[model samples]
Target: MRQPLFVTALAATAIALAAAANLPEPSADIKAAVAASTRTPANLARDQYRHPAETLSFFGVKPTDTVVEIWPGGGWYTEILAPLTKGKGTYYAASPWPDGNKGVQNKQTADAATYGHVKFAAFPWAEGQPKVPDGTADVVLTFRNVHNWRMGYQRGGTDYSGEAFAQMFAMLKPGGTLGIVDHRLPESASDDREKSSGYIKVSTIRRLAEAAGFEFVGASEINANAKDTADWPKGVWTLPPSLSQKDVDREKYVAIGESDRMTLRFRKPR
Candidate 1:
């Protein structure tokens, strides 16, 4: 049955609103953070592909929010997030290896003046007491770490990825957001590829998040790359940055740049 014109118009408007830009432009603080001089030139160069400003804006980060970054390998986002939250907010580099993970630790230590306010929290979470505390964080961001969590578990004493999602869910305030960016595997790809290659299916990610009590808020293509094929002899590492296949097809992989990625956001229901 056809609805009345007013009802139909309202329905269309709702759909359009849902499809529009989920959040506003990054605040001046975030833009300044991206342009901060503390960041190394090499890390700055990757800005074209990473689009740190746009991604964080889409995640709805604010200077006053308490943010946690999961498994911040090499502290790539730390250069921006740490100082962005400094003085006005709290930023925690949540890692499984608090003391052992040198990448973020060294980055924090080396730039104490800038990252001085940054805190470290054990992720995969400790048993005694939760590090960040349940229902406390305003935002939790994980960049390209989902596949590693899936791979870390052997045959299945426990599911690391599932646990990670549950922990993240617990640590978020009701209505808080979780932003994720990871290599995307096409829905057409075989399931086994997710276990071997660094790429993961969007469905798998949604299932994990939803099961952990998060509602799918929206997705963005801000970090999408048309050049990547998501197939390599040595997996996604065969691409630049890692370039695991060094010199074999260095030119080819360099041209491809980074893997195609999915940017997703979920909300802990209020």
Candidate 2:
């Protein structure tokens, strides 16, 4: 299906503006890694909707760069990132205290066993938590986790989203890329109400990143779903995968498919 004219124009403008930027190009090795046999059929089925290759390319990911993935729940992207960075660079899975959660623990163990040399970083959810070393990473990526981080803004007794962005900024080397993918709310949406809705305004996200001292690079509509109305009984999770409402209007939600997402890239100033 052809994209809407506005989206196409935005992409074209971004490409033209960044024409001189030495963005990383995908290689045969990265392609082979993505197509590796270790991936499950169920996970592979979501590729059409996710467009991992194009998204990763947009973020300027390379084989030999230190990358940190924040809140890798279930390690969906980890499955691809581990192999791609295995022999050359480094991959760190950062999450908030994995010890208590059985699922997170199991994922960490399985990742260690399946992909040797994978590292773990403790995401600071509490006071006095050790931070990832300063200026250490080449790229930092987060997917669909921004809303969750926003939920912690006050609930966690601290500004969670603010601190998280600051941490990601401190961890990256000067000029490193920060890639984010999250369900996008309309520009007019209320910021306070965004937590329960599981969607965020692109402007709000930009404000947080800029507060943490990042320069907005560009955005992509690779994960945009025109069918999504962003107004559902169960918010963004009403759509597929989460299907939070269970059997209620399952077909309708499934037809609408995933939530429309904003793919944004930011850079730490050199």
Candidate 3:
């Protein structure tokens, strides 16, 4: 009986120590900033787009690094990133056109006002190619936007997907991370399917990153939705949020929620 009691006490002590190790040091200022910014309905909805804690954690963001969020649409992550790095880190939003034509500029402007330190840089697709300085960014992130480049919208006769990956690879310092999240296509699908379905095979993304000089670290299923059949008639846009087939089967699509996304982490070789 005494042996069992001793073992139990030891286990409890170990558990307590582990919990203490994992707890982040609370910052009252960060909490206050997040509270102030998320008061609006728009900000609230944007935060709901993904699991904030999980997404930010996956990026390995701390309060003392220079992080760049590529194509930060409506500044969804911007809302979280600004406060997470409020006092110490720098957050830069890179995009094309400062004219606010594609909603990029507007989001950047709004984030700048709220975050104060959030900066913006022009990375126009029409400029032929992106050129980010080497060993500059500590963390480069792009969420659910790779499919747009795959579709060749404004890629300017270049494989924008490949070019974007290369640019990210170049921008990161040795040992820096590149976090990507995108709607996943069925593994059996081909590259051609991306044009129609707005999804790309996970393997294809891995290969692209590897080709662009990144080491594929691993992937997460944190945002995986097993219910998605990957057979929507209108592609991923047929699902919730975008709901391209609004009048046809709005309820069915709404029930489906968002597409299953592949969460990937890649590292620039040190």
The regions of model 3 sitting more than 4 angstroms off are: 1-36, 39-49, 100-113, 124-132, 156-158
Global lDDT for candidate 1? 0.82
**What TM-score does each of the candidates earn?**
0.88, 0.84, 0.79
lDDT of 3 by residue, 95-116 (tens): 7656422443554456555567
lDDT of 2 by residue, 1-270 (tens): 333454334334334433434434445555555565555556655765676666788888988999998888777787778778878999887777744223445655665655666677777545565446789999999999888878763356333788889889989999999999999998876776687788888998999999999999998877788888787887888998899999998998888888899999999999
What local lDDT does model 3 show for residue 145?
Answer: 78
Top-down lDDT ranking: 1, 2, 3
Q: What is the Å distance of residue 150 in model 1 from its true position?
A: 1.5
How well does model 3 score by local distance difference test?
0.70
Q: Is candidate 1 or candidate 2 better by lDDT?
A: 1
TM-score of 1: 0.88
What is the alpha-carbon lDDT of model 2 when measured against the actual structure? 0.77
Give the better candidate number (1 or 3) by lDDT: 1
Clashes of 3: 0
Which stretches in model 2 have alpha-carbon errors above 4 Å?
1-25, 100-113, 125-130, 153-159
